[model samples]
Target chain A: MLKLRWIALFLSLLLGACSQHVVLSDDFPEPIISQLPQPVVVYISPELRRYVHRHEPEQGADWTIVFGSSQEKLFKSVFAGMFEEVSLVFEEKAIPDDALVLTPVMRDFQFSTPGMSKSDYYEVWIKYSLKLARGGGEPMLNWAFTAYGREEKSGRSAAGAMREASRRAMRDAAAAIVLNFMKQPAAKKLFSVAPAAKAERT
Target chain B: MRCWPAAFALLLTAILGGCVSSSVEQLRQAPVGVLKEGETIVVLGRRQNFRHQTEADFTRCVQNTLTRKKLPVKAEQDFMDEMFPWFQPRMAPTTAEALAKRLQEPAIADRLKQTGTRYIVWLDGITRRGEDGGSLSCSVGAGGGACLGLLWWEDDAEYEAVIWDMQTLKSMGKIAVEASGTSYVPAVIIPIPLVAPTQSAACRGVANQIGEFLTKAIQ
Candidate 1:
């Protein structure tokens, strides 16, 4: 009887062990790490706000801005200096109407540029989308520019220089837009736009 | 004689249990092909209409998060021939063999070499379905008592997936995720049960959830 009881206990323990999920905590496969350092959060500048306000006011103030497409980082850096108080918001409705509605058109603009390829332009678009989506509640701005150049020695068309120039121009344009918006009373008015009763009281 | 029978039954259960346990272990131990540092990971997005946008957005969102986490990733346009091969019934067997070889070929191998990538991740599917409580029940019998239990009792949007690795040409993992979001109108209205305020907002919620999952796995 003693021997039988011991056997039953062992069997029960074995069954219990088998029934429970065997999670291997330590033997996990090592994760693959990339060589490039993770990409930085390139800030958008106040200039983009100014440019958008100037170029497209209806969509500028209420718009959620997306940064990057080469020009994205530069725009962020420039705009960081401009906004007196800038807070990143992840609100979905905060996204700009243009980004949601005009993505394809923007992609076309990027592709049509002389030196920039479809893929390169697509990267910019994607990066812009990411910045916008991840912006939390912060405003978004989109800008992309590319140039064309000819090889000096071979007299062949060289796109590298042109692409860089375009990227720079887009960055500058984004910065300019933000700056312009900062200088505009329209921006202040939009923020200060009050209910009719509140306006009357003020 | 009764003892002998009981012993035989116990032995049989042990054998069956061991087999099932080993299979799960094998799945966990399955080798994943290596993707080295600086290697570009190309992800392709496919779906219909607004659904396509959602999937693309999610894919890009994952890619960006991964990149930010320091994974060298590239979103590519051209689909590789080896990755997807065309073969008719008659040529299926031979073509399948050839395709497998092609996947292991030097061209793809060389590109992988360029950045020392040893792993490739492929996202195959995402689906959302309303849960049916009646269909989720299971029965179990113990001693003289039997009972039915319900599985997955929730009001939510769920995503399912099959992910594969390029190097080993094997599936790395499968995941199922569900989330609930509030639906609100312009005015502060009573919220809908589980639907998100907007589809894009739902997509963002899903992306963040997936990001958290990936972070847990990769980190």
Candidate 2:
């Protein structure tokens, strides 16, 4: 009995040292923006809904970070505030007629711990690619951007700090998209009204 | 009273070694105006700089101190949630001029009014520890355990707050604080710490000045 118990403990310790996994929660808040009067549709992809970052180094613990459902929630909340009428479609075929379509994909995810960086902070970097198109499959624009986040390790556990850093990186990406999207020439042409034309109309 | 002796002892010890020296200043750029009923203020800290990020606890201290002084203060997290990306670290305006431009946006302006926020204080700065020149050693044996030697360091805290009157979309004033102190840990058999509360002292000084400044601004 004693030998069996010792063997069980050793195996459990070995398993514990081999891998680490984390599931992230949603951290996005609905943004405040000047709403476009036009109706818009967002296509949420299955790949994004099941996005997971797996890291396996040569001599370190394997890490897996699951961002399930968080990305979809973020786009839903963000687009809800950006348009007068917003619709979410899980399938590409479900997009309605003549609606502006926005699709976002997670391109890459990377992170560094205190042990790796030799600093008292945990950092995460995320890359995103966003596409805007018409429901009829005509592409308007594609924008790629990167976001960085860092959290201090003073009073937080390693996992907690890394999770927070990841959330902050997502918010950074959201902020970038919100701040610059409307300023893009394509989007500007879509949303802006000429002052002379407006005056004439009024 | 017994309290007198304890207070005197504390003052003497602070005078002798571990004590904080602090200063506060305010720069008025425009005349103060009424804060008005239902209007509140928010203290926000900057985090965009790569070199340093303001301590979260320090900002909380400022908010709590302001609240303790009976000033109408809004929780920064709630305010930021309502404001969202506009007040994010990457999107937040660092200057009053930029803030004025942002306020021109109808949506943001409406959100600000809905939150009943009339004053926005941009707070920034950091605390640093340096000048370490001491050693502490401890040992335990069958006979007994003892610790001998001394460890000492210096800490400095500096902060600044830029006050903007959102109602007028102009900066009302600015407040600055600088505090420094030395902390010592000496051990004979055990460690005796004479620590300086430098950060808290700066927090109190800045909060006091802001409270007074806002009170005077009230019409």
Candidate 3:
């Protein structure tokens, strides 16, 4: 009996040593087109540019937490659903005469896991800051939003949970940005006014 | 003795998987100062593109906690409207530096000055349910019915408080609070579930920390 118990322990330990990979995918909620407003150009600052790359395995165990895809691309995908016309860029560009600009900053991202558990879980948190302005006007709005996600160790592979948490956190942040932007009077006023007639129309 | 191996695995898991885990860090400290009696402070949740109930709850929790500590703290009912009347559904300065500059603009500065708000506390964070799985099936025969299955999942909560001194137009400090735990629902013949106190734990922990931090700052 003692020998069998020892063998089981050894096998569990060996299996635990193996590492797994997880990816952070985008999950933006469906949009309400009528509710969404004017087109805006999006710019990402260099500071918020890193893809989620973190590995905090349980003590003496092997597992990795990796976020797949350029975080810049993932961010662009998020805002695409919120605006009628949208453009994303990493490098700074001069604002077009008739365009509104949005600058997003990835303030912080954190991930942590327990050293050991019957079920292994992962936690994620992200902080975001946004600046909005017209082509020539001083920035009218500046704000920050924070979102968090967790993968509870469960039936699916632990990797699935990790991925789910990352996606959810991103979605939460995106949702906050869209909702708050719509609430702003400036946003409302801008969108509320119908666009000018095309030059050719006359 | 024959089941010793299985029991060992269970024991190891329990020992390693601790209960509700949490921590708080002070990113920046409030400058040297003291709030005189009758001075006012306002707690608010940053309005985001979408509504975040946790922000409101956290704002209330912090305000109530601070008030209990003898600090005159309250939440502005129409903070967004009052502070940025011309621009609702608008943007706000994200960094302390940007905010300091924005507040310097005469319109915003005058409005805030009239309110006499000494400190502005912004509460932000998230709490969510993790993945869940399990299946159940039941059949009713001529005589009786039978069922079987199990379901389980985990939950987590994290929050941070950013404090700003209106007069100085600089960040007083920031405190981040976090908590997470697992829960289970099992069924051999019946289902049983263990609930996790993720958000409440974070709330309580953060509230206590803010209280303590303010008390110390006053002394």
Candidate 4:
């Protein structure tokens, strides 16, 4: 009886060993795009241009351009090509004359628009930065664009591709800026927009 | 005397065999990140600004995957409502500890402590963009490689996901993947035509690449 019991126990143990399965943690699913809108045209803010040219004299102006945009489609196409979704914020700062001169100027311009909401104008601000950097002369422009997007809800695979696209966008923008600056005429024309002068009536 | 000796040997063999088999079975059944049998694992869920429908789907997928793995999983809500009352509300660690305790089948009120969870996966962001001509490429290697390259510029979408270590709060890794091809397929249906010949191909391509990276990291 004891021997039989031992045999049964051994057989059960062996069977259990063979039947066991390896277990892994749960995997998150891929993110799905419920909707994708058409690409909106990105434009530079007029107020930003007025700010940059406010105090400068027009004697062969050296110009710099920085770009920003908030249009979802433009962001998806351009900004998404440069950053990961985890990045909640993007910022670019320019230093002129070894002092943080341009940031305050940009900051004041960013908040200056009263009619439009913050989000609507954010995209405008981003686009202006890109154009300004192209136009600014001998000007060092730092353009930082940030994005907050869908993450693992779309799965890790989707996120990886998105990050790659974002990095590419940033590189492309930088290259475009360099290429534009190499051309002297293009650079000069960027900041040639003149300030409104006081008119005297006879 | 001969029979007696044979019986003794048989009995010893059976005892040794049982021990070996039990150990093997325990090891085989162990969950990822668990070092020993009976060790507990904790499943955690994080809240983000995601669409409700998407959130439900993601939650279901994760829960199903975990259940299939046979790792005891406790929802965040259950852990909060029943397991650990002493833990401050909205605290992730407390909830993690509570869940770990449940996995171990411990006394409900006993202070169940763990080093940390095996994995923490979270969503980061999603985006889409249209591609231009400069983005397309074709190779002339073999099967169908010599076909005309299609240059389509439609908005491409991407999703970013991150995995972290629960205890140390150190980021284990991050994966960002873009939607397959340039076509916009609504999220509700599994790609139409039964198999999305192109999008499915693209999704698999991206999945394989990211999956390989993830597997290598975990191993």
Candidate 5:
């Protein structure tokens, strides 16, 4: 009976060692960009703020990754720094008149492990879709971008590596937003070109 | 008992008997100048290349080595955060000229001044495994276990440091280090691996030269 108990304990320990859980709640630094000379409304949806990912490896136990409030913090820091005046809104109707409304949706999240990829790296990729409109009207510009991050398996735990890779992926997404926002022609039309239309909206 | 102690010492020496060789070269474009008070240097790893990216640990290792050698270096992450999207992988300047032109922006220029950044060292390159040969095998029985074989491999590490004077908006010079070595593992009932410190030797070589280059006041 004691031998059987020892075997069971060893099996359970082996199973426990294969499971991993990661929670990301860290804050993103405020981006440094020339503030848009217009008022902006950032809408953070519940789906984006509280995202969770779960996956099971080939021979290991389940892996759960909880995004927590990182998405909310990222959008907050990004839009607040990009616009002169900023307001956080949950609903579309609460947007102010003549202000630009930016809404982001978490489209897809994927990750690959070293064992899976036959590489010595843990990688994370995040896809985001952004909707841009004026005063909660029809969407003037719709765009989707993917961001990626990778970390080498340099003696870090599975969960620790995944967490760092996820944060880098989020930061990469934020960079995509700040660096590519002004490059869109439709976006440029709304943010820069239409003085008369902007005056009316104001 | 004395023989046992001598055998243990021999084993210890064998475990640390890794062989490594290194070379360092530098090219200075302008006269070496002295650092001003309240000035800080930033050692940043360049990641624009898709084929090879400078290892983050190596970058930090250089930073730590420089610190131990008494050179002031700002934390790369903090410096990148303060610069924000400007220094992100997608937006960061690839060339010294591009960096100088980007510094012309008032906001970026002011941030550089506010952060008291005088020099920016960009680390680029990767440590990769070279040709390797040999293998080992092990076998076990109910009463005993024993293995006998030999394994060996080679490692190559090459890195370059491009120094840019942020204050003058000029390329100060470049420093390159190359290091290579072979590792061995011989098994006689037990495997005694002799690992090479090729990457570490390259890191130290670059860091020590950087220390000498920055500290000297030839201007």
Candidate 6:
């Protein structure tokens, strides 16, 4: 009876292992090693907000596994590294009188299956349109960034591969935003320029 | 065994009876309000590649069905021509949000308002053939002709109709339609192909739902 019980337990464990859903980790590195002088507010575009929350996969693709936080939260974490203060907002709200706003639009996020051989890598790609707005002035900076991630392990199932690939792509995208937006001349101007000083209390 | 002919007839009827099936789901509900007299709702395909006849046929079917239900819908071609003249071919917004924002712009907003467009129906989706498998073999021998094998394939399509409320410049709601079926062909000596009206069937299903949704006739 004990041997039979042990066999049953082993079988259960094997089935459990086989049926486990892929879990990805959010290990996106901050783009900027150091913080900026002031905080930058981040707004996710309405479409992007809905899309991330919807989490609908394209046909023929397996379910996507997001690591720890939702896409919005993950984005907040990445942007938090860009400045001393980072605020993530969903709806269009009154921005701090002096705050610069960064709106990120997810134009496309795609996951592709592996090649004929299951060992082949799966591809994950993300496209972002980052719009920098200051005090309702014409968007000061409009940049589009595309990043790709590949899963090379043969053993990882398609969903697992997608998770890894998507995680890496997000990280790569964050890195690009940090470097491109922070280091650019316009971004410097944005950081240094004081929000139109409130009519000097005259 | 003499009843085999009757059995085959019954079998064929059964197989053909379930050839096409589609369902509509309201992912978002339409806002409560009556459209003003003479006000129009516009139907448009959301992709450039949709200029093909198949897409046009789908769009027209939806418009006609809605019109039949007493909803005032604008001609897709007219809407496209007036709004997106620069593109030569018709153009559609990249995203629903973008279109919403565009509709709020004075230039575009003024034009759309002038046309009395209260709701914009975005028809986006594609009908496609899906997985297929089977084989057919045929040959004429000295004794007679003999053929044996099976040929089959899948036909599937998905469509989403996202309704935008021009008044609020927001998405009122959306409806998604999914249809899929398998087509079979049998061969005794020569391959006989059975083509399914997959795309046409999907078109009708989506159009029927749009009609029902707009008319608020859905139960």
Which residue pairs overlap in candidate 2's backbone? none
- In model 5, what are the clashing residue pairs, if there are any? none
Off by over 4 Å in 5: A1-15, A96-98, A193-202, B1-16, B95-106, B217-219
Model 4 off-target regions past 4 Å?
A1-202, B1-46, B49-54, B62-116, B127-157, B182-219
Comparison by TM-score, 1 against 5, better one: 5
lDDT (tens digit, per residue) of candidate 2 on A82-115: 7779889998879876888999889999999887
Model 6 clash count equals 1
TM for candidate 5 is 0.88
Candidate 1 lDDT by residue in tens digits, B1-219 = 345544544453343221100001112224333444443454433322112222444556555665676555565322321221111111111222343453355444444454444344333334343333322222445633222222222223344333345556554554444444332111111111222322233334433433443443343
Q: Which 10-residue window in model 4 chain A sums to the lowest lDDT?
A: A193-202
What TM-score does structure 6 among the candidates reach?
0.45
Ranking by TM-score: 5, 2, 6, 3, 1, 4
What CAPRI grade goes to candidate 1?
Answer: incorrect
lDDT of each: 0.33, 0.80, 0.61, 0.30, 0.81, 0.63
Model 6 CAPRI rating: incorrect
Model 1: residue A183 alpha-carbon error in angstroms:
63
Q: TM-score of chain A, model 3?
A: 0.64
lDDT of 2 by residue, B99-196 (tens): 67776666677778877898888888889996887899999999788776778889999999888887777778889999998887766666668898
lDDT (10s digit) by residue, model 5, range A64-117: 999988888899998877777888887757787787889898999999999889
Residue-wise lDDT of candidate 3 within A42-118, one digit each (tens)? Answer: 87666566444555545554546554444665557556655657877566655575678888777777765544433
Write down the lDDT that model 3 would get.
0.61
Q: Can you give the TM-score per candidate against the true fold?
A: 0.28, 0.81, 0.44, 0.24, 0.88, 0.45
Cα RMSD, model 6:
18.7
> Each candidate's chain A: what TM-score?
0.30, 0.88, 0.64, 0.23, 0.84, 0.68
Q: Distance (Å) between predicted and true CA of A191, model 1?
A: 68
- How do the residues A83-155 of candidate 4 rate in per-residue lDDT, one tens digit apiece? 1231111223222222211221134212111122322111112122432222223444444332222222133
Point out the worst 10-residue segment of candidate 6 chain B by lDDT.
Answer: B83-92
DockQ of each: 0.01, 0.38, 0.02, 0.01, 0.38, 0.01
